[model samples]
Target: MDNFLEIETSVKRVFNSFRHEVDGILDRKLTGGEFRVLSLISSGVNRTTDLSKKLDVSASHITAITDSLVANNFITRHRSEVDRRIVVLELTEEAKEFVASIEQKKKEMIVRRFSVFTEEEREQFQELLKKLAEN
Candidate 1:
């Protein structure tokens, strides 16, 4: 029990630290929720229902976040061809480019944060994380 608690604390600390670093880079332009929505849209997650279920967020929350995304021209919604009642969300060209830029920045930020670890150590860390995930 003590070990599990320690692991949980460690995980929370690391996750929060990384999030703070990313927030610093984003300059308060994007909240984590907005970033998540953008990433999902960019990765081909198109339906509001699908995103809500996949992210385990409330429908209202998803709607609120998507509204901001739409306002910023990061995403647009259209009626589905097969199901007129269903709406499909897609990234605009500008949004696509923005997503790419943010992704690159995120990668660089992570690399910079982890650069103190030797390559072998980083690989080992990844393997351990994978193993933990599998369990």
Candidate 2:
């Protein structure tokens, strides 16, 4: 029980710290929810239903994020020609470039954070994270 609690606490601390850094990475232009939805669309998860499922959030919550994205001109929503009932989200050219730049900055930050560890240690850390993700 003690070991599990310690692990959980440490995990939460690390996660929170990373999330804080992400806000800086976003430069206050968007919230975490907004960035996540955009990232999902960038990754080909265009449907609102799909995004809600992927993010484990309510449809209304996704709608709120999408609404903000639309208002900010980061995304445009349209119905699929084959399936008018379904809405598709697309990143504007401006958003595409923004996402790309943010992604690069995030990658650099992660690399710098992990650079202190030896190569073997980093590989082991990655394997551990992958195992947790898979389960």
Candidate 3:
């Protein structure tokens, strides 16, 4: 394989491993689509149309995720006062707590992983990653 393709494949493998490891350790059952919707709601209250645009998904797909989240009690809908027909989606406190717990576990796991690298190596790796991300 070409060097660029090899790097791309390695990146994909790492991403998949990270997802599987974190999901297994946190015991969070969210599918990638569900997590994307939850992430959008966590950012702020948004109308379904806006969420569909932000997520780059079909309107019907966004509606399905919102409906599932609502049914699961992870999100709640509020009618806009000025525009009675418009509804906004907001994450519930319970969902926030669930997200927090999952985050905490992931942080712990990352911290444990950090122990494998020397302090200087870790710092340099982080700095280089931040620089790469900026580009």
Candidate 4:
């Protein structure tokens, strides 16, 4: 607790715990990376390059993830009408439904997990996390 390394490890453990919760909520239907890409696409990040930059991964990695999503019928890739060279990603109808369902489940899980914290504590914790993330 006194050392930065210990704090870092604790933070990592907390992240891992959340990831595990998400995995359970997803029922192993999607890997964490795939879920992330889908979430970003749903939020209107529709370009592979943008996704790569946002996720801080290589374009090739995005391509691979998109390929998997495509094969699973979770997304579609199309050429931009204004720029044929540019690829745009979009969620399929099935993906939209899936996203909604998963979001509900995640919300429930978050509520259950954070129930120990009062509203003010949760708000303060979120603000602290935002500050740390910004720095």
Error of 4 at 67 (Å): 0.5
- Model 2: worst 10 consecutive residues (lDDT sum): 1-10
Q: All candidates' TM-scores?
A: 0.87, 0.93, 0.75, 0.93
Model 3 agreement with the true structure over 39-103: per-residue lDDT tens digits: 77787747899888987889999889889999999889999999999998888898888777776
Clashing pairs in model 3, backbone N/Cα/C closer than 3 A = none
**What clash count goes with each model?**
0, 0, 0, 0
Give the per-residue lDDT of model 4 (tens digit) for 92-122: 9999999989999999988998999999999
lDDT of 2 by residue, 2-54 (tens): 59989999999989988999999999999998999999999999999999999
lDDT (0 to 1) per candidate:
0.89, 0.95, 0.82, 0.95
Flag regions of model 4 displaced more than 4 Å. 1-6
| Candidate order, lDDT descending | 4, 2, 1, 3
Per-candidate RMSD vs. true structure?
1.9, 1.3, 2.9, 1.4
TM-score of candidate 1 relative to the true fold: 0.87
Error of 4 at 74 (Å): 0.6
